[model samples]
Target: MLNRKIQPASYDINEINFITPTIHQFKNNIPLYIFEGGDEEIIKIDFLFDAGNYYSDKFLIPVITNAMLREGAGDYNSEQIAEILEFYGASVRLTTNRDIAIAGLTFLSKHYEKILPVFEKIIKEPNFPEKELKIELNNRKQDFLIENKKTRFVAQKKFLELLFGKTHPYGNYAELSDFDEITNEQLKNFFKNNYNSKSCKIFIAGKFNSEVLKFIEKLFGDSLWGLNTEKNIIKFPIQSDINKIHTEKWDGSVQSSVRIGTLCFNRLHPDYYKFQFINVLLGGYFGSRLMKNIRENKGYTYGIYSSLVSFLNGGYFMIGSEIGSQYCNDAIDEIKKEIANLYMLDTNNDEIKMVKNYMIGQIMRSFDGMLNTSETYQTIIPYSLNEKYFY
Candidate 1:
């Protein structure tokens, strides 16, 4: 019988195990990582490239190139490709991040052979049609214009500018005018340069077979898929100028959004886990100091959170919240006091133990399936890291 009143006793995290994918090299220099089997007939395949927003020569080139991949590629137009995938109950997605662009596919293992050629064609022969490019440009530009009016959007944009500075790749933003300047020729050039096997790493999971593996090797490994394009040099020099607060004033804003943080060491550091635990105790969880004092006790704001976000080259620790405009100053003061308290006193051993346990549970839930396990591999491989990253 389970007791609702009594709580389970806490213990130190003893061990955490992660599934590491078996890596194979394709003849064309692309590396593929695999997690063998699961109960589901479905599988996920991912193609990762460093052609993210960071690598874009201009603000929109990388994104525009990635977006136009499925718009038209090798015999199948956008609607035809969509119809085929929809008929097979499969899906395709391309996501652009600060560091990379991922082209992902999910389909039943039975359809792997049928769609592998289509996938190959999509990867190697994307034609950025003028009609599709025009439609996408207008849609994205109009969407941004609408979202730009929100306080959250304005705050997040300003936050990146402050964190990375105006000159850094991560900081430079695409403006409305930049959208108008995107050209099909530029997209073609960028794709030829960056979206090649030389810049790609692959990950696949679910019920795997040797035939499918051979198919992958033949399509990607045995061929010169990228035509051996040379990668361009993109510089991202870090700035020591931090510890500054950037405020974007909005006259109509009834609520003030605040982002306070500083760039810190990435996950490769030994102290990262410790710092992550400290962040949780500070505000990473509901019972954290900031939430308890600011929201639960003082009636100041609705919510608050602390995060230690690790990137490919750098990381940052941030405490974020939005509050009534009138109490903005008070909220800032309280946030500082909470942080100061951490350095001012030693944390209790029991409290530290609890946070560690919470993190362990979180990791278990995150890596629960083969798909998630493949994602876990994706995150680590970008940094030249392996399973030991967790321990």
Candidate 2:
């Protein structure tokens, strides 16, 4: 029987040692890379492709291709695929950002052999069935229509357009007409152009035997497909020189949503850490200056926040809030005052320490799950960052 007794006061804390991950890498002539780690039960598979909206026609192709990936594929219809995954107690999901699309799977390691075929099918032979496309388009259109009614949504859209010109891919709004124009043929073409093995990296983080590694290599190796020779170039747009603000009034709105921001730099910037600390002090937490001054003290609004949004090419700092419609202008003015105050005053060491501890705590909390940890590393790896940044 295992001992359940509590430790004595004399117990030495230094005697305890936690097992850290054993990192392993598989190198092949193939362009793809896989990172794996785990001990027994769960296996996670992440397939990353550089086929984000920024690289394609910004309107629809990126989104449509990602959504339709699991609709149907070789030897499996959508229902069949779902049923098989559920039976094996597995989950498959897709995530996208401005620069990449990630298809991830988490399954019991014991049943990996049963689920691997389904994964192969989804990756190798996505059919992009016509019916699924129609259903998805309708759903997206309805969502957009509903979001347009919210003042916050309206403000956010207008803010992006103002920051980056309306014609730019990062700033454009999606129209129902745009969805109407996308056909199944165009979706298939986009997939064909972007889904080649050369542009992808497969990351497997979990317990696996030699067989699984061999399977991954075979699935993504020379036997399956060849490298893409075309150049993938992305250019960052020029930033707006002047500070701009725009608002669109929504009739009968009970709350006014506000967003304030300007273009900044990427995670690789030398001042990234300092800027992170600054953001936390400004609005990155419930106890932040913005929240304390605007919500807790004055009671001008229900909630407020500020954050640094980092992208592959550049980043931005934004302050967002929702206030009673009558208090919209007041909330905006107060938010600006707080920002100005930070620049005007000399920050004390005690306050800086408090904010630093808060930010560190928040980051630790975000990594409490396997999925989130894997994603954190994924985001960092592309930017050439390591765990030392957090420490």
Candidate 3:
């Protein structure tokens, strides 16, 4: 085996400067902002809205609206949209999380001028064609049904239900009945209420000029801005007083999946970094304590890991593992023992230094590409943070 201790010639990472994007406040009096960058090869545009599921009449409204946005708009059908975008070598993506929805576009800088009009039509006039909605709903329901049969899925869903009550927006699972309950009229109403200029923020990165800015102004600024019909703020319930444990058996499974966690704080909390460091020492890395104890030393499982997940409305620290079904109880007991030990004693200086280095290396890896960098910002912007937090 190769030596893992061969240090590279240059350990200096000073050249990696995390620069915050230049912000340009639009004069249009709309809730629009832009982050301008100078790369001339690729251009990215992100339209963010608070149309997340929390504000909808039902849990799946945001899901349907986001999925249907790119299916058809204006004179183009789903296939035509795909063909046009492919012809220009451009990509259009739509994503929805617990509290926000984003529609984004990326294309070669040379073709940006040609592709901007297509994006404008898609964003401004999406037609929720009935046939497309039925197909998507059926596809999603089937996927969910399949996933529910797995041990990991059972453990994860149960863990969330335990952390937050089953009725809570963050904890609720979508049912096939819920999909059938959704109608095209409800989706259109949800879109009209949330996808207005006043509720959106635009982010542009890479190769923008005065003319491009003018085009953006004409397309987005001149449009009438309307406020959302309703504003609902999601408040995560307090962490449960009890340390909850749940288990479900799936017959004929070779391995059992386990998840353990509790509701935690958002990124704005001062303890976010501390908890992140603690998590690394516990199970965040391959060489973490949990892996060493469960996989390396005991040979009970192939892998084990944990993470701190922060959403717009709330966050949590989760540990997950898959092991031979016979070792399920033993693995869970060891995990709890490790967690209790972390709270009882302090880690040593050597371990602390190693975790810090590992975290820094991971942060650098996350910024290695343009798309990843853009996504990093998208994840952080909702917390009212800039890149400086990571640097």
Candidate 4:
């Protein structure tokens, strides 16, 4: 039974400890990190690579190559692979961002042996068949067309291009012609160059034991797979303009979306933690200054927020919102005022304390379960960091 009327206690957290996993490296340079917890006989393995937008020599090639991996592989066609995964109650995901791409899979421990072969096919034997490649390209082209028509999408895409220059990998976007230009041969070449076993690490989380470990080692350990992929370096510099405002007109539009941001630092910078703390006070939360001023006080829009986004090469601070087209100027004015206020006025100790508490709670929410905990650790591995940083 729980108390209904009594006041809850107020407490402070002194330290946080994460149950970091045990690491086991395979014969091939693939490292498997195992987080052993949870009641159900399920395990999720995440394969992470430094292959993302920034790694591609051509626009959209890295992501397109990653997405096509599951379309056809080995002897199984797209539909057949889907049916097999579904029959085993397994799930597969392939996603990419500016910094990296991840291929994830989850299944019951009982079906581990049965499901392993299918994943092996996806990893080592992706065919990048022509029919499937064409279908994927056409569908993506349609999505791009639809997305470009949306005001928010236009604002976001234009913002990135402006921030990183039209030619930068992180800043550039694909044209419809670019999608049409992709060939199955290019996809095969890109996949071969990027998705090698040597470039990835495996994160396994859930109720797993010695037998499960043995099974993974037997299947993946002895095999000689993956291309020797070195970390990419851009010989040229990526540049961004300052104090830029871009306005794109969409006829018959009822609202205008706005993005205000500039190039900043990556997570590896020493300023990362303090900048994040300052960001929470500025606009990182619902109770942040931007939301309080722009949305609640002035009713400029239903929502407005800011973020200090971290990436592998660099990061940025963006303040975004969708408001009535007429009031877009007013909202921008108010946002500037809020920033000026932060600079002109003395720092508020109380605000910092409150934000600290709120961020602690947010961190707690992120690690609330076993799978989430494993995923949390998975994020840190790419940075060459470990659980010790958090502890």
Highest TM-score model number? 4
The global C-alpha lDDT for each of the candidates, from Candidate 1 onward, is: 0.83, 0.74, 0.80, 0.82
What tens digits encode model 2's per-residue C-alpha lDDT throughout 1-391? Answer: 6566966454212221212233443343333333355455788888888777667755577887888888899979899998998999999888777778888888988886688878887877899998988998999899988998888888887787777766665666677688788888888877787776766766666666778777766665535353366756757575463665554456686777778888878788888878888888999888889888889988878888888877777667888887777877877788888878888766888887788667766666656555456666777666757666565
| Candidate 3 lDDT score at position 276 | 95
- Mark the regions of model 2 whose C-alpha exceeds 4 Å error after superposition: 1-40, 222-227, 239-241
RMSD of 2: 4.5
For model 3, how does the per-residue alpha-carbon lDDT over 46-98 read when each residue is reduced to its tens digit?
Answer: 88888886675477888889889988898989898999899999999898877
Best by lDDT: 1
How far out, in Å, is residue 25 in model 4? 1.6
lDDT of residue 29 for candidate 3: 47
Q: How far in Å is the alpha carbon of 219 misplaced in model 3?
A: 1.2
Give lDDT tens digits, candidate 4, residues 41-117. 88998888778888776777888888987888999999999999999999998998887888889999899889988
Which residue segments of model 1 deviate by more than 4 Å? 1-13, 239-243
Model 3 has an lDDT value of 0.80
Worst 10 residues of 1 by lDDT: 240-249
**TM-score, candidate number 2:** 0.88
Better of 2 and 3 by lDDT: 3
Using TM-score, rank the candidates from best to worst.
4, 1, 3, 2
CA displacement after TM-score superposition, residue 358 of candidate 2 (Å): 1.6
Which of 3 and 4 is the better model by TM-score?
4
Better of 2 and 4 by TM-score: 4
